[model samples]
Target: MENSSPLVLMLLGAALMLCLHPLQAQIDGTGLFHDYYAKSCPKAEEIIKSIVEKAVKKEARMAASLLRMHFHDCFVKGCDASILLDDTSNFTGEKTANPNRNSVRGFDVVDNIKAALEKACPGVVSCADIVTVAARDSVVLSGGPSWIVPLGRRDSRGASLQGANQNIPAPNSTHQTLETKFKLKGLDVVDLVVLSGGHTIGLSRCTSFKQRLYNLTGNGKPDPTVDQGYLKQLTTLCPQTGTDDNQTTPLDLVSPTKFDTHYFKNLESGKGLLITDEILYSTKGSKTAALVKFYASHSQAFFQQFAKSMIKMGNITPLIKPSGEIRKNCRKMN
Candidate 1:
């Protein structure tokens, strides 16, 4: 046979990868069902909801933290709970990654839910599924739309610190960067916009968006996309020297405690906290800009899309059947 063309080789390589990682096709919920745990652990989601409800009642921000944990966990390694791993002698965990360290919280909440599930139905529920359920419950508790989460995800045996750092979109990521990051995860522009709405309730540390307040583009100027009034407030809260990294501000200043369309409204008014958030609106002629506007005007549309997108996100490359283990401790390999 004649030598294969470069295009043919590329197509063959893509096909081979799909065969090797068949779970990648599951992002659309191919092998997953909404009640995958109904028989194995009937009370699995209920247990998670109870714990998350109490936690959020005690501290409302916990809802956002839990939601963020799910996002971080999924983006790094296909929602496999690699972000939940703790550093060990043999491996460094994703927890220490630049995007996650001091940012992603709610591991204890996951632990609490896992312990409850273990008591109720030992070894039946996976920590990965626990995080997924907690995320759904967190949204519902925080006044966001809820969806039936498909289960049967298993925990990975390894962590990917590098993947966490490189894959998770940073607070300073550009519009193109955010789009590419979501696309790499089998998500689309709509997914990116709707998922970003999760920011409507979360708290972002000063470190996450200090550049927008201080030295954007190393020019020693605030991001012009930021509202001048909001910039003044941010400068007062976050200093020009940028020392208070641990200090947090709500990602959505309009209605920080509620998971609503205010985040898109903030973007429209140049009040978005992070460059990544603001760019969704400021990126001229971008599809994301249009989506932001649409969501801002029609919250019902945003809520519906958010629920659908979240389900799609939860389905990212789950390890089914005998592929991964049901971890006893979410932070350690089984």
Candidate 2:
């Protein structure tokens, strides 16, 4: 009986480990695992989380910016930190891409995280993994669901200026265009609706959606789908002319700094801040409209699906060891 009890305990321990680190089994196939740095850099995720928390504390909007960085990076070149590269004399980077130019902020925070990680672990952690982990931490700090990020991604040697401009869905993207863009990345409609929830904690510049408030569809009238009061509010914040295009407003007026279902709720009431945002609920016979309604009514469901979708997005064509190098500096190839 004593021997049997010991064997039983051993089996239970194995089961517990499997449950705790399910992605560990994929380290061989996908070259990613929940504990990819368990031996190489035990404090990789901890270091990232701490830096992200400090950045978000200083500026709540930074949480969304960091999260957006991950999305933009992954969409451009499979989340290998290609978006982090800066243009040099001989090369152009994605920073100047139409979708990214002056829009994607938080590079300084990423550089800070990278500097700290490089100091602690040297070349053990890659900037790609740091960006991915920082993104998850940003969401958690903003009151969103937490998920285990599969790590071990390496950095790309080059940035894709063309891919950055073409791949990312714009604020004026149609529902079909958005879905097609996501599909190209192996994401489906569910991923689209849930991932769009990321706007819940961020702000959008006036230029991104100003047309919705004035001259949508080239007409001198605002988008009829926007609620009358919301249209008035947006117009005041984003005037037709002589307004700074860089002026920003909360993407989710209900709870802009906190990650929640308010984005979905706002969509239901026609207060969605972006044309792309409103399209999810306002487009005629949109498959996304049902999803927006479902998520609006089920906050927990939105949170859970969001975590799953993020994990899926993080897995897009990662460059594992031997395929790419670990970049010491995120801004330029090392």
Score each candidate by Cα lDDT.
Answer: 0.88, 0.91
- Estimated TM-score per prediction? 0.90, 0.94
Q: Which model scores highest in TM-score?
A: 2
**Residue-wise lDDT of candidate 1 within 129-201, one digit each (tens)?**
8898898998898898988887788899987888988999988888888989999999999999999999999
Question: Over the full model, what C-alpha lDDT does candidate 1 score relative to the true structure?
Answer: 0.88
lDDT of 2: 0.91
Q: Which sections of candidate 2 miss by over 4 Å?
A: 1-24, 27-29
The regions of model 1 sitting more than 4 angstroms off are 1-29
Residue 126, model 1: Cα distance from true site in angstroms: 0.5
lDDT tens string, model 2, 1-334? 4557887989988998877663555644566888789888999899999999999999999999999999999998798999999999999999999889999999999899999999999998999998899899999999999999988899999989999989999889988899999999999999999999999999888999998888889878889999999888888888889968898889999999999999999999999999999999997787899999999989999999999999999989999869889999999998
Report each candidate's C-alpha RMSD, comma-separated, in the order given: 9.4, 2.6
